[model samples]
Target: MYEYIHGKVIEYNYQINMKKTFQFSLCGQCYNVLVKLNSKAKKKKTTRSPSPSISIAASEDRINKNEMSSEEDNKSEFVLAYKLFVKTADGISLPAKWFQESISTVDKFLLSVYNKIHLMTKDNTIMPSYYFMIFKTQKETGASTQLVDEQDFIKFKSEYTKLAARKSNIGIYVTILQPSITS
Candidate 1:
């Protein structure tokens, strides 16, 4: 004899607590419905993607080892630039000459900094887009920065430029919590 237990996955009672049992014997439509429900449950059980912040831990270890290696070898400009960036971002405040030469793409550098600040931000209401400034050099001053949307990549760049300008001595510092237009 065929039987069908049409109920929620959680409420389903099984002989050995196995809720996925498709009733061993059932009609074609009932079997289809069970298969569909199984798919839905599978989707719900899947985990969400990891946030970018999780990368910080790994990057930190790589940075520390690189620093030790840099001290041992006088050469290695890449390590030197990365160290300068890490220091400046960590509030050590390096001179502008160090940043004049390229380290990484400005976008990548800014995104890393933005991610760091975003993770530290206390206010849940303020999105990453809201925190920004345009870093301008002495020559390229007076550039405008606008927050475009939720992700607001444009606004982030603008904010970076402004901070870079202000700290033209060391390097720009753009924080997610800081308000560009305080009124």
Candidate 2:
């Protein structure tokens, strides 16, 4: 998965999409550990598919964040971006050398499922902007929960909360924070 994201980072870099970003192979052995997690989720049937509206909204939000399209007063002062492109247009690919076979299996499953995920949070706007391109996965409850990059979402949450602190009405603002994916 990391390798795939690394490829995305490269693409964005080459396309001049992301200007301030860096890539590194952190904890090569950890990829296997993460992949193993996917198998466990599969066995437990913990996969979910996000609503189509949510998927589109998330992708658009990512584009906006990357472009910093919000008004200065409406934008969050803190934002982070991550890349996740695994395959080349011509089918060339890189092997993920982080985990063992078990983990590799999980990584493969997630790579097949999760595809690309981008997260963003903005403030001072009418609603808080949250978006993701979640993959389909079954949830432990025999229900599908859109599989998403928990880490990237976490970063968005942290930054969003900080921006939210300045708002007067949390509940009212919270409602605005959610993306109108359906529209």
Candidate 3:
């Protein structure tokens, strides 16, 4: 069986063996599913692996704490670093590095980026509600994905840090949606 979500297709497999079960992979991680064949079927005990994003969030918290402490030692405030780009008619603009302090929510971070874009381009038509943001895993590959508003930002940063094999700033792409005309 296959499941589609957010432009990604997930493949699920059923194993016919002594223990009947299903397995699937999502977001580069694998998971096992237990099926109850009949009403009388006894529930099987199974252990689930921690979600990749959850684990990444935990690690990111630790990393953030360490970063703050080290920056304090240097008598400088710690800031979350990001590279921002706006997608326009021509193409994505050159990345601009933004260092933000004490932003915990995605909405607030996006608002800051929106304000920065407005200031830089002096575009009055750009509305905060009309634009959405995404994180690009690689600049050359253009592998971008939308993140949930909850804890996904931390997870994304953690993944980027791991991919770069060091502490690195995140790259955010902002795309503005045009208002629809109704006749």
Candidate 4:
């Protein structure tokens, strides 16, 4: 409590709005091999990776340290991850590749989910409920326990444009989202 005689108004203005949050959960299969990934694989340096813009590999240091980490103890390590529970715009909204089959790799899943959301969603801020993160999981429960940082949300938006340009032959149109509406 502030004394009315001594307290001066220093800060003002606050908004009351509940923003929907998005979150991702690891597929059991992806978690199985996430730790075994070498530096190259973690960086997604394989021939099949579409481009650096669409890549979502963890850093070299993490991969190196987790080199010998058995898949059994996945609850012990931290990795960058994101989630997208896609709500379509009344059709098969997912890309053609994903429409037929499920994603298997964490890197691929991260790229695909981010790409689709960036491509289709009007409001890009997926926070409080959904997020991109580097989180350590709980060993006892295999649940995310610690957060490192939020992944660069704007970077995903940029990647969507770059991917569309690079794959122009596929004829994907890039629409710019207004900055004020989304963070």
A best-first ranking of the candidates according to their lDDT comes to: 3, 1, 4, 2
lDDT by residue (77-172, candidate 1, tens digit) is 221121122122234433322333432334555555455443444333444455554333334445434333323443344454555566543233
Instruction: Name the weakest run of 10 consecutive residues (lDDT summed) in model 2.
Output: 168-177
Cα RMSD (angstroms) for every candidate in the order listed: 19.4, 25.4, 13.9, 21.9
Any residue pairs clashing in model 1, and if so which?
A: 132-159, 133-158, 133-159, 134-158, 134-159, 134-161, 134-162, 135-161, 135-162
TM-scores, all models, native as reference:
0.23, 0.16, 0.44, 0.20
Q: What is the lDDT of residue 17 in candidate 3?
A: 41
lDDT of 4 at 41: 59
For model 4, residues 1-183, the per-residue Cα lDDT tens digits are 122111222333323222434344655443544444444454465456555554433443554355445242332322222232343333333332222224333455346545565555645554223433322211223433222222332233334345445542111222222232334
Give the per-residue lDDT of model 2 (tens digit) for 52-112: 5675466546545644642332233332222222222234332221211111232343443
Error of 1 at 7 (Å): 64
**Clash pairs, model 3 backbone:** none
* TM-score of candidate 4 versus the correct structure, residues matched by position: 0.20
> Once model 1 is optimally superposed onto the true structure by TM-score, how far is the C-alpha of residue 159 displaced, in angstroms?
16
Best TM-score among the predictions, by candidate number: 3
Worst lDDT run of 10 residues, candidate 1, spans 79-88
Ranked candidates (TM-score, high to low)? 3, 1, 4, 2
